[model samples]
Target: MAELDKECLFCKIIQGTVPSYTVFENDDVKAFLDLSQVNPGHTLMVPKKHIINLLDYTPEDARRYLQYLPAIANAIKEFDTNITGMNITTNNGASANQVVMHSHVHFIPRFEGDGLKLATRNNAEKYTSADYEKIATKIKEQF
Candidate 1:
């Protein structure tokens, strides 16, 4: 297990120092209802170990954490027949709107006409195939 941050809220929850409406828990991960529900069945999944964000996750840790999400999300879907889809999101940093330092995945159940939309304004700039290739090469170089 990674060393827990004594003051991290998620760490407190994992330690049972704070109360959470737990939906599921296993050796390496925990899922619970979010206090501020984006929808009625919104949930958050976090690794049992203290990982600050997605970039901090090792492949093994990420695999362990992600393996449980599908099952948990499916169960949430069963809670409402009206659930038409779901959104899985993880904000990596403050610039990405990550309020908590500890890593978490949001499982938001969606229904038709829920009035929720994930969108971004269009940019007039367009890239050519060479631009795409250059970007891909740059990313691949890091790997």
Candidate 2:
């Protein structure tokens, strides 16, 4: 837990400052329906204690947060059995299109490219296994 902005939408939801279609709640985590759904039963999970992004979360918080994934996935599956698969995304920075400043995970069910599009860059730079290992090491070191 850390200092939080009472005005943040997510913070307000966590505090019961604002209304939400919440499906789950506990001492450390909260899950609720997304206002904008990519698919029916789309949901967002957040830590009860405010954290700005992945960079602001601790390992313990990350572990606890992840513990709720199976339940969320099951709910999505139950709601849309036709879903062939799913995607979990969390954006950290503005360039990544993270509209909300608060940290949260999006659970979106995918149905045969129903809502997915990505452009390929044939000549894009590539990283080797060793290069990726170095980057991973640096990221872990920052935490």
Candidate 3:
């Protein structure tokens, strides 16, 4: 947990002010159905404490949240038996299209050609193995 904004919607949910159709909850994490489902079993996972973005999270918080992610994804798969793939994503600032101020991960179950189209224009470059190694090394430095 870090400094929190009491006005954040997810914080309100954590405080039991706003209602949620929660699928899972632990001492520090909450997983619930997304109000606007991209697919039948769309779920949102959040820390009970407020965090604004992935980059803002502490390593300990990340480790704790990650421990629950697989379980949540497995539950979604079990709920929708026919799911073939899944995408776990988190958005950051408004420019990145994050609608909520609270940090959350979206679990989107994917079917073959589910007609989902993501931004491709900025993803034009094909990186080499060396490039990936460099990027990975840089991120590891921060950790």
Best by lDDT: 1
Q: Locate the minimum summed-lDDT window of 10 residues in model 1.
A: 119-128
List where candidate 2 sits over 4 angstroms from the true fold. 1-3, 118-143
Question: Higher-TM-score candidate among 2 and 3?
Answer: 3
lDDT of each: 0.91, 0.82, 0.85
Residue pairs in collision within model 1: none
In the order shown, what is each candidate's alpha-carbon RMSD? 1.5, 3.2, 3.2
User: Any idea how many clashes model 3 has?
Assistant: 0
Q: Write the per-residue lDDT of candidate 1 for residues 7-115, one digit (tens) a residue.
A: 9999899889999999999888889999999999999998888899998999998788889888998999999999999999999999999998999999999999999
Q: Give candidate 2's TM-score.
A: 0.79
Best candidate, TM-score:
1
TM-score of each: 0.93, 0.79, 0.81
**Which segments of model 1 are wrong by more than 4 Å?**
none
Q: Report the Cα lDDT for residue 61, model 3.
A: 81
Candidate ranking under lDDT, highest first, comes to: 1, 3, 2
